[model samples]
Target: MNENKFIQLLKKGDEKAFETLYNEYASKIYGLLRSYLKEDEIEDALQDVYVRIYRGIKGFKQRSKLSTWIYKITVNTAKNYLKKQKKNYLSLDFNLEKNKFTSKENVEKDVFDEIDYEFILNSIEKLPPLDKTIIKLRDIEGLSYYEISKIIDKPVGTVKSRLHYSRKKLQKIIEEDQNEGNG
Candidate 1:
């Protein structure tokens, strides 16, 4: 069945619809939560999202598409989880400028000096929240600008511009690593 049919079943509280929805979006939801939450917190947050969907499905009003609403819920839920952790733990708004690596200055043990996909992901981890989300949604998740606009509740033009800027920022970070290597 199509998304609308599944949503109709979900609205009616059909258990089968829940299973179908879970089977379809489980990996996407898990990937999203994994990007933003700890491993232990993932399942809890995922459960919370579904609970919110169940209770709020009636009042959804269709202002946005179902998946967009789900994506927004996922992002909000993850943010709430992080906020609770911020009280006694690390500050999430970490500074990337302080962590820039210089290969020439720190070459004592060259075993771990190689730059690769995981290295790039580490650099992405240091970006601001919006930039990180924008890059992930556009590049990693492969969502289109229109869908991303709905998911983020931003104007389509704004989504396009931010996506462009996000990719540029990532590219610049990559270039920094290259220049550091060349130096």
Candidate 2:
């Protein structure tokens, strides 16, 4: 079915369609929420995001893709959650965990990769919220600049520039970390 039709069904409170929508976007929304909320808060935030989507679906104007609209809601819901909780720290739960290794060499490589991934995730956490969000949306979520622009209510050029600067800053942070480890 077309997205529009599915959305229409969602608007009309069609249970099956809403279930489909939830199944489709749940993991993506959860990952996005993990970046903004603490682990303990994630399940609640995910529920809140879907609740907002369900209630707001009728008012959605279709100016953006449904996914973009959903993402915007998720971001706003997370901000609200943070505000309510009065928390200062943000976490990017980019769970790039590796589980299976074949040989000693592969095991060593996996360990190094896990360390590198952890270092990068830590570096990203140090970024300002906007930059962190842009990085998550583009690099982690694989969203286009336009979609990010819509979700964050910024210009496409701004999204592009921020993503560029964020990547460079992350690289510098990683390099500095490596130098310090070596030193």
Q: Per-residue lDDT of 1-183 in model 2, one digit per residue for the tens?
A: 998898899999999998999888888888778778889999999999988998899999999899999999999999899999999667776643333211122323343354555666777777877888887777666678899999988999998778777666766776688789899
**What are the clash counts of all predictions, listed in order?**
0, 0
lDDT of each: 0.68, 0.79
Please give each candidate's TM-score. 0.71, 0.80
Top-scoring candidate (lDDT): 2
Which is the leading candidate under TM-score? 2
RMSD of each: 8.9, 6.1
Please estimate how well model 2 matches the true structure, expressed as its whole-model Cα lDDT: 0.79
Native-vs-model 1 lDDT?
A: 0.68
Which residue pairs come into collision in candidate 1? none
